[model samples]
Target: MKMAPKGNDVIVSDRKLEMILSMKGGNGEASYANNSQAQAIHAQSMLHLLRETLDNIQLMEPPSETIPFALADLGCSCGNNTLYIVDVIIKHISKRYEASGYEPPEFSAFFSDLPSNDFNTLFQLLPPIGSSMEECLASDTHRSYFAAGVPGSFYRRLFPTRSIDFFHSAFSLHWLSQVPESALDKRSMAYNKGKVYIHGANEHTANAYKKQFQTDLAAFLGARSKEMKRCGSMFLVCLGRTSADPTDQGGPGILFGTHFQDAWNDLVQEGLITGEKRDSFNIPVYASSLQEFKEVVEANGSFVINKLEVFKGGSPLVVKQPDDAAEVGQALANSCRSVAGVLVDAHIGDQLSEELFKRVERRGSCYAKELIEQLQFFHIVASLSFA
Candidate 1:
């Protein structure tokens, strides 16, 4: 893999970043739109939690009558998922102003992602302002909603200071700004061997992954702190592990890691990919524990935790049992391929992705019966207010 310098000293390669940004877009079979049902469900579950915060923002008196409610969704991928979130916010804010007998402020919602995201596809899917609402509030009728796509990585500043009133991110922050340098360095103690991530790795390798997550998360919080108005709130939902030990084989990372390792081993036996290539490749994801998440937020000191909760195994958001093994496997395969296909393709070459996913789908089918009973995944939903 080629390594290129980028960001604030983060050693991400230009090709890797480009592959991640540009590969998943549009509404094609491989697009995130078709594969992100679980993510959409998680985003829906957060709507109730966000209601109070949206109301509180409406209660605040704006410095001027014309300043619109500036809202943003970081890592807004191409789909109706983001539009669904925006609609929820618009509904709550409009109702609050109507109940208070005040004219509602206009909305300016920014959808942000890496530069290669399919903004064209996103705009085409978005319903015109009030079109999707069941009953448009009187305030909504008078006020217009302006939407724009702001292309950039959220690991750095993407907006002017104090410009945003509210922000959201879903299923995106778990990815580090870049892979840990030590993991890729042959001389380093953290050099991961024969596995893509820290799963089944030594203490040194695990800690290296943790350190990178901390650095990236801190940068994320710091940038948002500068961009948001005082008292502004952000709701973030991302993959998390129940275990404090990074090496524990208990989370979705382990599940995916096991499957990928098994698949690669089969491919190697068939002489499809070299052993060195398998050893060098690692997925740039870390499912942080609740404690780890709290530590990062507290250390940053820019936001106060309003609500911090974890939905563990068997949670509605994590487990959705399907009717049959084939259906279950196909759904899981679609979701995994949509997000991870780019990385896998980049590592081994795009020629093998279809065959790789086919093997993955077969393995996934065997687990359908088990998944029907329970799922081992968890999610951390955090609601924070600027301090």
Candidate 2:
């Protein structure tokens, strides 16, 4: 058994980790593709905003078929969530074109994510483009559109300037390009000592995370602005801090046993890995507060905020039935694993990652009923357009 060693001076750099990080792929039980209902649900709630954007966006000079309507889903995880949004956009625009007594424009939809994302699965889930809405419904497929995969980071430009008529992302933009350098530097005072995330960490550690998020968001908005048409808009939803409180995870506070830190702490106590080694590893995600998010977008100055709201989001992993309480822990663990297992594996090894999550699952199951029944989180839903 290869236990991770703390003696190594250099860990895998954050840039390398970022390149390889992606949601668990494939259709297995643990795959992000299967476990991403929470994300899809988040998108569903933003349909009103999406519809509003579609109504306002003018893509073609006369809305002709020759000028295909172009839209891109940034950070499109390996799930049907992107497809769902793409379908909605296509349907909405097609209806408008038909009402104007014009031939409905051909649609171009791009699914984008990191190079390591489960894009193969995402592509497989796509239906034949240009199918009628009724045909799509009959086959349990999505709406009509030409589907293309754009493989790269969204932090940089992925489309030609002023080409995309609509941009959509959901539950994805909080990921930083890299974890803060200070958080991983043991010699630095801001080194995250005990926690795997900034949630409940010291002020220095929390600030480091917040700064990184702001930087990445600036780059993201900058890139999107170049690609968006003058009248185009973006609709986004992301998991975020519910309040001004730094430790806030939604409203109920973070679950004790189900968090990544609990599992890491258990491993450290068992001497499977040194505390120093644990300190070196941190998940590169931030749940930005709405105020913090708006500050960045405002600072960027490329886009004007159209709609922004924070609301409580429900989790399917919550324990609803008395008979099913036992499964809550496993569900919670699976949810976390699906989103981050790859990063964990890269930081530690596959074996250590498995054991760590096992401890989390076991502990979570034992404390299932004691945990919050709602497991609600706050989602920041926003719509923005070029300034």
Candidate 3:
């Protein structure tokens, strides 16, 4: 039972400062696009849950004239995944219109992410206006499709009041707006020493993470509340823990953190990075339990959960037939590096990330075979309607 942080000595920021928490952009070797197969799988799973909610929107009485339907994908990184999601949504909506004998409303899609995200790459990958529609909707319906990038943190309001009709986000909300202040404050009991995240950390460290998540999640819901129209629905999919216990270490959180720790430890041993640097660093990610997610949504009193589920995620690192440890290890390392390289580089210097991940690949090779066996990775999908 670790003691909680004393008083309010932790320096909490009033303003939600924009920081560089996005994945490596573009289609480069280390880019998120190349390493986001697992995320793409999660997105595909979420589409099944979104069909009903989207049908509900079409069920609403047809408005006078073709009112432009607005859809926003929050935390849309630079990749074809977001475009693929957008296409799916548009295709489903078109099908609903066709069934009801109603003309499909023109689409006004917004792809949003932190300012640092590669909008250039995203736009480049976006199918030409008529191309995507031709493949799904009938060519006769001259339903114009428009897309634009919204750059900023989703923890704050990004769209106008009551503008969004549908909102979707995948594999993003698990990230907190910022690292917990207590984890960085040396005087705080919640200081997370010698860990990049709250893996095997103390109870206080976990509490610190939980508190930050609650705040950020509230802010997220509040912002969306203002932007979403009445009866509008949001689909969110992200990593989550099954158990309420934060110290269980039975999930992806611990597995990934342990891999990073092992890599960092090797660096320390090699005199590449100092032990003190490793002690002070903590990744700004928290995987919440289903109960906690419900609590936050209910506490917000704005959105009602239409659907909530937890499902195991298939590991992208596994290979069929003869499994080569080296190949498997490198695949796992690349996946982790693509998403976390930015944060790791910021703290430990960009010069060492390549070498550090190489060590991680080598160290993680032995356990690569067991990656797919663990039932730790969970995909939490929730469909929420504005109440």
Candidate 4:
């Protein structure tokens, strides 16, 4: 079994820290605890890029220094995402090793997230598979260490300089807990209700977002530059917008951008929350126009773009309710369980959450049926490597 680092009060790994922090304040909206269909698809794309990149790399000749082959999943929150990404890397590497008639490099996998994530939830799910990280401690396949709960904001200093071989970040970086509140100020035209474009109004807001992105991008690359071996590869898949228009939307067809706004409105109309509370909460996600994302990567000196692809990241979850109120109520209860904390914090309260369900039940299945049809999301994936 992989052991925790000595002297650390929190036993979580670095990657797990990234995941947890990404999940903090999610309460119900973006909890990693709830499985999304996009997880597997994102994993597949990451694995594909990793395999291709690894195949093209030229291993050093004998008498050379030892090159530690490592893979890290940044913002790999708790639940299936962390494990799924890890499995993809392992499977891809194994396939290439067998085909080339060469021994596989030693593998060290890192799972990073924020300090607030559930490390135990992730640790408990580590696969006890053959020649896995645990088994590699004694065998030759590779030594895989499952470290948990390492903070992701420390991306610049994430790993030992030049120590990583392969890296991946999925569905995590889009969230910047520190995004300025002004970015969401509706009066500024920077954001319209349900609109997600960054044009017009305050140049300062845009610049602030830009500055953070630039700093984070630089830190991310710089940190990886130190930790990655020469010619190492990295893949980053994040939630992004294909359009520059705030109204343009994509992603899982069910949870469209409108649904988010609608849900917020629901809470507001019920007198369970206030505008001040809404203003305080900012989902620090910027759906980068392809141009915006490229500019950020180009500004960072250490890495070069290999393949940049924008693809679908989520599917609509069809919510079907029975004509009867009782069964329909149960379904709504289960759906909101992950988001209950946020709802209560918004002043809906625990008792209110239940009452809200009852309200949905009273509206009958028609309103619930209409809700599932309207929500959707969008995303993008970019693959890069050390220059």
Candidate 5:
């Protein structure tokens, strides 16, 4: 099995965010469009909600550039996904402007993620979107400038004062870098070891996670307060732990336990590794309870929650496998080609890469087999606006 480098071996570019949009000699759209189905549903739902929310509020007769309307897709993994969402928002705004006889406000978009992201890849994908959208909105003569990689913590600086209008994040924010070391210092081995943390383990992990989340939530709100114009909206699509208790094998969250268990068993069965120490590799993400999520959102002053939905087991966003598993596997392989490059760069051996993919295939297959139930839950997508 490949060994992850000491320290944060996972860099943003290495995670395939860059090459997702381009791969010579590959099915370009298929490779980059894994989230297309989910994102389409989200974009439609979000735009409708936004319009409905704004129906009651009357804007001044003349639209002014000073009151620019903006939207951000934070933790925007693929620039392609960002493009799709932008198309939806722009289209909606344009339709509204036409019906109401008002010129649409210029849009400034922010695509933010960690500093390690592949901005080069993101830049390459943006031109086509801009050109196409510019053509469509030519009558409006509105300008859309695509900004590449606002690098930093989403929980911190991703924009300037009073700049953002609408914000959206998808499938991110659950994975914090590491357990806050200070909070974990007093915990015991069984709890910290990342097992079936029934009682002591569950309570300890939850408390520590909540603390970090609160700190991060405060920072996120603080930054956005300075960045968002009054009454601007935000939509956060992220993961969460479904259950408060860890004892139930199917206790929602991104089942790190299930993923680790399968990974460990595979490594052991292949005779490439040994021991239970693999549990030590547990990535401590703060998958808070729903109430905890609500608490943090309310605590943040600049924003007011508009809508929050739980997609449990599966939702419209869940990707379904094609009838042919082989085709699905191939799609996944192409999509993950850059990830293989990252693995090799991290010194994970080629033989191990093949084995890892096999494990992933089997896991995906298992999930598909049980499609009627337990396809993993996306914790929530909270819609918010400037208070």
Candidate 6:
């Protein structure tokens, strides 16, 4: 990344960020396909909200049965959860329209993400276990919906004006389009010298992260505003914070990245990788507060928040006994890797990245009690639409 002047602020291109930023693909044990239960759990817990949006949504004019109701799941990575949520939304919309004495509309659902996403696996999962892929997906006449993948960053426009009827995203917007160039510039005040993230970094460093999130989120809303229909509803779920302090990491406020930080330090001490490698590494994600989210939405002057709620990150672990620490640790490691392993791999090579997660798994097992009992995240779930 090079420092280019953007009217005084140093910036770099997002080409590298888009290329390297993707969850582990395929159905391998560590792949996001298998390890995305944490996301699924939170999203499933809020299925009612989807129904609520369907119930209360007031489209400018109901889409005719011939005009498919288009819904796009932004930042939808590869996994069953993507389809599961899309399926529920479609069913609910059909039921709602039917109950209102209107014909159930055909649906067009889009699964959107970066170009590197495992779209093959996602598309293959469309056909049921016994049904032949060709038979299930061959004709739109046999089904009530059509499924397609849109590959791109949501920070930019990906759809036509007033094309999308609804928008849904979960556990994805925390990622900034690019890591703030200042965070990696050794000469910048915001450079995170010894840390991989801003969880415990200084005020300048933390402010840089906050500014990046603010900018990215504003871009997200701006793009969505143009694509979404006038009265179309949008449901979003993203990692958030309720704490007053921006740098709060007390009681697992945020502890996942520390494993890489610790292991990278060891690698540096043992002469495996240079300190510069670890120093230059920073995760391009942030958990904004509900206040910050509202501020951005209000500032954008497009969408009006209908429903907003904060959910405690419930443990996805199913430990039957206290001795099931190994199981607990394994779950934690998989969840971390599913969402965040890409950051480590991008900074250090794949080999070192594997070694780092292995170390994280080992440490997680030893500290299973702490991880399970103390690990908590605040998630913000909101339903919004054009005012």
Query: Judged by TM-score, which candidate is best?
Result: 2
Per-residue CA lDDT of model 6 for 85-107, tens digit only, reads 87778767766675677766667
Runs in model 6 deviating more than 4 A are: 1-14, 59-63, 128-143, 249-253, 316-322
User: What's the residue-level lDDT of 369 in candidate 4?
Assistant: 49
Inter-residue clash pairs, candidate 2: none
Angstrom error at residue 326, model 3: 0.9
| Model 6 error, position 312 (Å) | 1.3
Off by over 4 Å in 5: 1-47, 50-63, 127-134, 138-146, 180-191, 194-201, 241-255, 268-277, 284-286, 311-354, 363-368
Strongest candidate by lDDT: 2
Higher-lDDT candidate of 4 and 6:
6
List model 5 lDDT by residue over 72-174, tens digit each.
7776655466766665565666566657877766566777766655556666666533454446566333335445467666777677776666666765666
To one decimal, what is the Cα RMSD in angstroms of model 2 from the true structure? 3.0
Each model's C-alpha lDDT?
Answer: 0.74, 0.77, 0.76, 0.53, 0.52, 0.76
User: What tens-digit string does per-residue lDDT give for candidate 2 at 220-308?
Assistant: 99988788889888888877766686555453235332355788988888878888878877878788899999999999999878888
**lDDT ranking from best to worst?**
2, 3, 6, 1, 4, 5
Question: At residue 8, what lDDT does model 1 achieve?
Answer: 18
Worst 10 residues of 2 by lDDT: 1-10
**Model 3 poorest ten-residue lDDT run:** 3-12
TM-score-wise, the better of 1 and 4 is 1
Q: Candidate 4, residues 48-94: lDDT per residue as tens digits?
A: 56566666555544333244456777776667667766766755665
* Cα lDDT, model 2, residue 151: 85
By TM-score, the better pick of 2 and 3 is: 2
TM-score for candidate 3, please give it. 0.90
Clash count for each candidate, listed in order shown: 2, 0, 0, 41, 4, 0
Q: What is the TM-score of each candidate against the true structure?
A: 0.88, 0.91, 0.90, 0.71, 0.72, 0.89
